[model samples]
Target: MNDHWENMARQGSRFFGKMTASLSHEIKNALAIINEKAGLLEDFTLMAEQGRGMDPKRLKSLAGDIMKQIQRADGLVKRLNRFAHSADEWVRTVELEEALALILSIAHRPASMREAVLEAEPASTPLQVTTKPFLLENMIWACIEFFLSENQKRIRLIPEKTSDGVRIRFVGDLPLPESSGLLFPGEAEKVLLRALGAELRMKPATGEMVLHLPKGP
Candidate 1:
């Protein structure tokens, strides 16, 4: 039992680190764009100081670009903050849709880098469950990373309320192999999911992976 807890701790730490690193890269990219736009604005200002006519439209466009990047950076930071706080407890009441949305927001970064689209279909109704939020996020992310690695063009997530709890279905172009390594990645992830009272089922014909999470933590 002690070893199990220790392993879970390590897994949680690794997941947190991975998420933070990805988020940092996203923020860095946004800042780079903002910096370039600001530099261009400075050049425009210099031109104006030299009595050279400035294109009002160009200046307006540059300002708009900077603002857009700023908003993007702000949103990324907010998501990162929420993710960090999610680990504050071992288990908590989580809104299935909101949790899935948060994980998708972070996982979408890697998908975008690979030129693949990752989308989450809005849940038809609110689905809430009690579980380990951080571990659940890690499991979802691993599934997404696997699909993205398979060169899937688009991956979709659909969350629905189940009789016992909630079910999140991951749909993509390719079917996941039945091998434990391909689906769960590692023993820690598999153990963590079981600890959360979650079950994963792969539907080869439908090209979907469905995760069934119980209502109680």
Candidate 2:
């Protein structure tokens, strides 16, 4: 592979690692809760065996808590699985709305870390696009990262179907940088845009940045 593609691959791998690490942490948290619950259950069992008596209601509540953790881990796994498979194909037809939601799911934690709320408004109808799914996610995440770095308090994403293409707009509560030209769509992002055959439009005055992705070629 050439240097450019190789760099992109390495970048994807890094992103994958970061996400998996975050997921593992979350899953671990759930597991730890379950373990604590198990210990309580064990305590209850011991009490019953010693004739000290155990509350059946407490046992039922503990079981429900364990079930909740299991369901949470299951959801995390499903999302991570979908994300991993997004890299399965170099290019494919992807439903834009589903893709947008997936990226937001994975990015919610990061956005929260920056004290920013990440919200999305889905298109009235599903928007489909032929593109590099992995790279496409990376680009959206790059936009999320950019907005998260801003002084803005909230970042709202909306995917719209346009006559010529699809416009994914990121709207913020505060004004985008007056010098967004200098800070955003950096060289790396430009490379990604070229790779995806996409365009980035920044409306700093309106606190909006739009990514225009063309339909299948």
Candidate 3:
């Protein structure tokens, strides 16, 4: 186990370092393009081409739009990169709220594409537990994907600290079929639950699926 963990750590570290360097260069190139465009706009205003000056208000609006896109892109890259580095540690205590937040970030684009809304209420207190971060993320993603397939357009994630560990309640807008378990917690999900020392329960009447995890995986 020690050797395996070290190997994973070394590989993940190298992967993250290389990706960060590459993305830094990419962002630099992007910013260079934006700067050139802005400079051209300024020159147009200065030359007042054809005796018509560029509108300062329009220029400011365009710049604001560009900045917003840049900020959004930066945020997405950070969340995904942090998630990718999750394997750097084989096992550790993780804050459940933070984990759900990252998973939601990853699922946001897909949910949007499907015209679905995903929301998560911040837990009042941290729900911390020891687990395999990457697998936990995988399970959460699977849950999100599974629940999204239902007719309900809005899916909510509620995090709670269980007496023995942590629980994340995935609630749906419509009442779920009691046989929902027949569709989810399938063979693969069961494997994940087993490995994580977790349990998945269906609450049909309440329209929710609860994932119960122990203090350690």
Candidate 4:
């Protein structure tokens, strides 16, 4: 049990590190856009000072672009902050849709970079579960990373309530490998899911992966 927990801790650390790195890159890209826009605004002002009449529409457009990037950065930071706090508790009640949304947000940068679309199939009702939020999220990320690593173009998450608990279907076109090592490299994802009292199943024929989570810890 001690070794099991130690492994989880290590895995959690790696997940946090990878997520933070991706989030930082996203922020950097947003800042770069803002910087470029600001530079263009400065050039416009210089032209105005040189008696080159400024186009009001162009100035307004430039300002709008900068504001848009600022808003984008703000949203990313809020999501990153929420993710950072998920580690504060060992286990908590988490709304399934909300949790999955955060995972998708954090994974957006990498997914977009790979030109893969990550979407959640709309749920008619809320699915809530009590579990280790951070660990559960890491497990989801592991599954997503596996498919994204394989160059899969589209991944969809479908959440629904089960009689006993909740089920989240990870649907994509990439098939899961036969070997456990290939499906879950390093066995870290397996351990994390097991620790969360969740069951994972993959259908190679249909390229569907399912995660069954209990109602409570």
Candidate 5:
């Protein structure tokens, strides 16, 4: 393969790795919850077997918990499908809301695991943006994965507007100490964003990581 193709493949692999790691972490948490629920059910069953009195309400609650877990597992599977096939390379004028929804949906599991919220607010209208959908999604994914991993349960994303563009800000409660030097995407992600006339700025102060996308182009 040519060098260009090789580089593309490598970038794809890296992006996939970031996503898969987050997904695996999500699946693990889901399984753990399922296990705990099952154990609770087993305990209840043993109690009934020993002729212990059981509240009808308690049994109903246990069933409800199991159903909730089933739904959680299903949601994760659907998200995995959306993310695994995100990059199609066909340029499209994607709706910001829909695009952000997909990004947040896939990112939900990992973000929630850390006790943080991934909040996205698009412009009031369709807010169409021209770019490779997959690449943009991957860029946001990279930011979320990095923050969540480095400072587990410490990140939150908020959308804001700049004079010339839109900004996705990531705020953390316990920001990484100033003395600790962290290498955020910096030049590479910036180069890609710049080509699309977008920009990203990571500020450890106030625990903010911002992505600036030009409103016009």
Candidate 6:
């Protein structure tokens, strides 16, 4: 089980690293376009100053578009940075709401691309817990990603009371029979979760998935 946890961590690092790299590449392209557009605007302004006719409004519009893309690139870089630091600690108390929010934010792109909405309940109280924050975060992330990749219509994180602690119910459209094995494809993720003392229950027949975690100290 410890091996599973370690494997999960490695897999998660690789996965998120790839994602960040891709986002960085996209941001770089956006910056290149912005640079080009700015240069064009500068040249157009220079030509206009020389009495050569130029549409100021058109130039303004192009510059505005460039600004929009620059803003987008900035946002992507921030998100990438946040996801990259998700595994900063081995064990600690993390606010459940904040953690969940981060997971949702990180997953927004793929979730939106797949047309899947994540329905979260309104919990006024923070669900704090002391555990392997990185592993727990990855487990939740994996579950959500699994749902999206399998083409599930939606996913929900419903909290419920459990004898030992809290049970997070992940209810979504049933995944294909063949897709079950894909839930924890690598030993890394599984071992990590096991080391953190987590429980996973998948019941396709009941259209239910559960992650049971203990309350924080």
Q: Clashes in model 2: which pairs? A: none
lDDT of 2 by residue, 73-123 (tens): 999889999999998998999998899889888887777777888888978
| Per-residue lDDT over 77-169 for candidate 4, one digit per residue giving the tens place of the 0 to 100 score | 998999999989998999999999999989987899899999998888978999999999999999888878767789999999999999899
| Per-residue lDDT of candidate 3, residues 1-217 (tens digit) | 5654554455445434543554555567557766776786777767785687677887887788678657855875786578777878979889888888887766765677688899999887967989988778878877887877876688999998878988999998888888898998765667667668899999988889999999987
Better of 2 and 6 by TM-score: 2
Give the lDDT of residue 96 in candidate 5: 60
TM-score, every prediction: 0.89, 0.95, 0.78, 0.92, 0.64, 0.74
lDDT of 1 by residue, 105-182 (tens): 887777888988988898888788888888899888877876787677789999988889888888987765556345
Could you give the candidate ranking by lDDT, starting with the highest? Answer: 4, 2, 1, 3, 6, 5
| Candidate 4 Cα lDDT to native | 0.88
Runs in model 1 with CA error above 4 Å? Answer: 178-185
Please give the lDDT score for candidate 1.
0.84
Candidate 3 clashing pairs? none
Give, for candidate 5, the lowest lDDT window spanning 10 residues: 179-188
Q: Please tell me which model should have the higher lDDT, number 5 or number 6.
A: 6
Expressed as tens digits, the lDDT of each residue in 1-217 for candidate 5 is 3654555456657777867777777777777888998998899899999999889898898788878877887787777787766665546566666767877876776678677677765555445566767777767777777777666465556665566756677666767556323476644454456455667665666667777777655
Worst 10 residues of 6 by lDDT: 176-185
lDDT, candidate 3, at 74: 82
Q: What is candidate 6's lDDT per residue for 1-217, written digit by digit as tens?
A: 5655456658777667645655677778789889889888888979989999988788879979898988988887887776667667667887766677766766665677688888777554556677776667677777777677667877887766566766678788664454475654346656655666877777776566788888652
Predicted structure 5, TM vs. truth: 0.64
> Candidate 5's C-alpha lDDT?
0.69
